[model samples]
Target: MAEESTKSWADTDSESSSSSSSSSDSEQEEVHYLIDDQTSDDEVFDFSNIEFTREDLVQALNDMVHEYKTLSHTFEEIKAENASLKNSSAKSSSDELEDTDSLKIELSKLRIENELLRSESSELKAEVEKLTK
Candidate 1:
């Protein structure tokens, strides 16, 4: 069974290589397939025959580096924005506290003024009674 499986794999590999060599990139793309995690072990194919030249590898590495740098820059920007938002939130909370303190001070002053007005009114009423008597 193992020998038969190996022979079948070899036969398929040879056919693929021959056809790929004769076809263009688009045609090769059509012939290739994607397998999922659920694929059986026997269904999985190795990419041993695929070869990358030095230029191809270098270009791929450079592209990956550029992508990494871009993502890192974006992450830093988001971190900075988050920090700025936190600072603004803290500042707003402080400002609200200051406003509440000021309002309390003003209310105390108004209460004192109200008491003084009441006392003056009482004094005026007593004088009016004396004058009437």
Candidate 2:
């Protein structure tokens, strides 16, 4: 069983190495083809025939300004929402602090009551002993 396991591991290692080398070779070929395609594509686009008019420039600028206004409005809304959430968080934190203080006060009161009960119990026990005597 041990020998079979070792043999399978070695086979897997060799298969992985061979697959990796094959993949690398295919990647190199793809890169070479991409380079050739890019050079061929670059020669096809003749930028000398393209023209830009004044109207086109004005339209593009107007579009940019409109988009900026929309974005600014959205940013202000998000900021207002963020401020509202921070205010609520602050209110809740103060409430939590008050609750913690109240709990601490209750705990101290309970401790004192417990001590009183213990002392009264000891006094009753002493009285019972005296009665028996």
The best candidate in terms of TM-score: 2
lDDT for 126 (candidate 2) = 97
Q: For all the candidates, what are their Cα RMSDs to the real structure?
A: 12.3, 22.8
Kindly report which residue stretches of model 2 are placed more than 4 angstroms away from their true locations once superposed: 1-50
lDDT of 2 by residue, 1-133 (tens): 3455556667966776777777878876886676566655554333222464434445555677799999999999999999999999999999999999999999999999999999999999999999999
- Residues 1-133, candidate 1: write the lDDT tens digits: 3455556667966787776554656655554543233356654234223663434445555677799999999999999999999999999999999999999999999999999999999999999999999
Over 4 Å off, model 1: 1-58
Give RMSD (Å) of candidate 2 vs. truth: 22.8
TM-score each candidate.
Answer: 0.55, 0.59
- Candidate 1 matches the true fold with a TM-score of 0.55
